[model samples]
Target: MLDQLSYKDKNTFLQNVHTAAILTYLAALLLLPLILAHPLYLLGVFLIGILAVVVSDAAQECLPFLVMGIWVAVFVMILNPLLVQNGTTVLFYGPELPVIGRLRITLEAICYGATMGVRLMAIILAFALYNAIVHPDKVTGLFSRFAWKSSLVVSLATRMIPSTARDLSNAREVQQMRGVNFSSGGFRERLKKYSWLLEVLLLSSLEGSLATAEAMQARGFGSRRRTCYNRELVRPRDYLCFLSGLSALIIGVYARFAGYANFSYYPQLDTLAAASDLIWLGVIILCLLLPLILSWGWKHWPYLRSKI
Candidate 1:
């Protein structure tokens, strides 16, 4: 799926960064979605997420996910007002619905819903960025350094998803060539036809698993200490990145505790803690943009000398 995106193979600073640094950065990004409830802060989070997506070169792959996230936000906005009947100011009243009777939409509810929706979107985008930047193999290998057996299980599970997807696509194409119409059929007919395709997928997966087991056994996978190829060296730059991420996380946590990042949507929105928040916001923005800045600077460094 990510292969469809431009810059899938582009060498970026992030690709060379230590896995620990990436994990630290992700942890900091993940915390923002959980703590901040203000619309402005959520919007900031969303923008940072967009920046991450762009830097990771996964714009094409991110579009569908972004659309789905927007749909989810819309769904939350519509549904929240129906279920939640709190707040004083009512915008409009709707006719009594089946299960939820007497729907009353209020300004407070709408604002609250908007906050929740944007929070959801921000979280999704953050993970999408992480997925684009971090390879699963590298993650498994990192885990293997600490716990080999657990890493092996995770690696197998991760491999299964894409492998199964590929098998399904191949099965669909072969079936289509043989005039097995999966699309233009009655509901029951399509169900039966698709069931056949699923059956093929299952069989192929089982066979593949068995073969993998045989190969592992033949190679004596568990007989000795497993060695990892492609060892990543931890450079000074990686240490700097990791330290910066850790500092940001600590500061963010402190800010949250100090109520600098607090926002309320119910019973009228609370006044934004502008002074402290702006400081925290700047820190987050710097943390997020650092990777992009480094990558761009590295790419253009040689060209910079010609003009100089």
Candidate 2:
């Protein structure tokens, strides 16, 4: 059992799948409220994604993982604020464009922007967590079970983007040291900088790809039958975990839409007086963090009791 649960095996992969599946469902639930009404609910969901990313990448030693996490956070926090423009009350006057009026920053708009940001964060975190935890080769093997060529392509693509991004960053550093101004520029200048960056990155990637191709050819990459180094066994615990996560997600979503998990902001946002509503809120919070609770209890119950 210890060997089966080792980092060399499928335990981490299963955990990632469990997380991805749960987050995907959570994102779906958040999306409905965003579409129907109450954009704040959507924002709440996105906040959860940010939390997941922080926790998941807290110990990632790889440069690519760190870079991706940073990028994800920036995209959600900064870019998301620009897109959403809805609110009941206008808080402040934003800049006016040629066509758009004096943009007023309303609570609704901020909430909407927040929702968009969080949604993006959640999806990106899910993918990043999967990449961090699951072996690319194991992913390919799982894919090969269904379609070998397609699986191989997907696994390679997933691994390649981050590899290429790192190479681009390194090349940019070299160019910067050689006195190329990547930062000192207007919008057009920035575009020019990126063009140069792309050129260098493409050249580097072409060389890297040629090397990879040679390595693949030497190792019989596309041969009739390819053997994998690690074999992941799908266990009962894996199924149980997946099922529970899925069930909780589905129920939570249904409850959300059915008005059971609904929160309001018109009359009041954070006023919880009634016992029934409090009970319902408790259920929602529990479901939202069910995965976290299960993982923690399983990993630390004895230690927690000892401390107590």
Candidate No. with top lDDT:
1
Instruction: Write candidate 1's Cα lDDT for 1-308 as tens digits.
Output: 43532225445666667888887877767777787665666677678778777765678767777888999999999889889888778899999988878888888898888888988888887676666677677778888887989989988887777778889999999999999977797999999999999899989988998999999999889999887769988776577668766776776677677877777767766776588788887886677667667656656686532322
Model 2 stretches with alpha carbons more than 4 Å out: 1-88, 92-97, 156-230, 256-290, 301-308
Candidate 2 residue-wise lDDT, 1-308, digit = tens: 22211223323323444333444444544343343233444444445544444443423422344356557756665544455444467677778866656765566555544544554544555455444455556546666865987986786786676677688889889888989887787989889878988898889888988998899899987776777676554444345445544554565566567765555543224333356544544554455454455445444576632332
Q: Give the TM-scores of the predictions, in the order they appear.
A: 0.84, 0.53
Evaluate all candidate structures by whole-model CA lDDT and list the values in order: 0.76, 0.54
Error of 1 at 191 (Å): 6.7
How much is the lDDT of residue 101 in candidate 2? 63
Report lDDT (Cα) of residue 50, candidate 2. 46
Candidate number of the best TM-score: 1
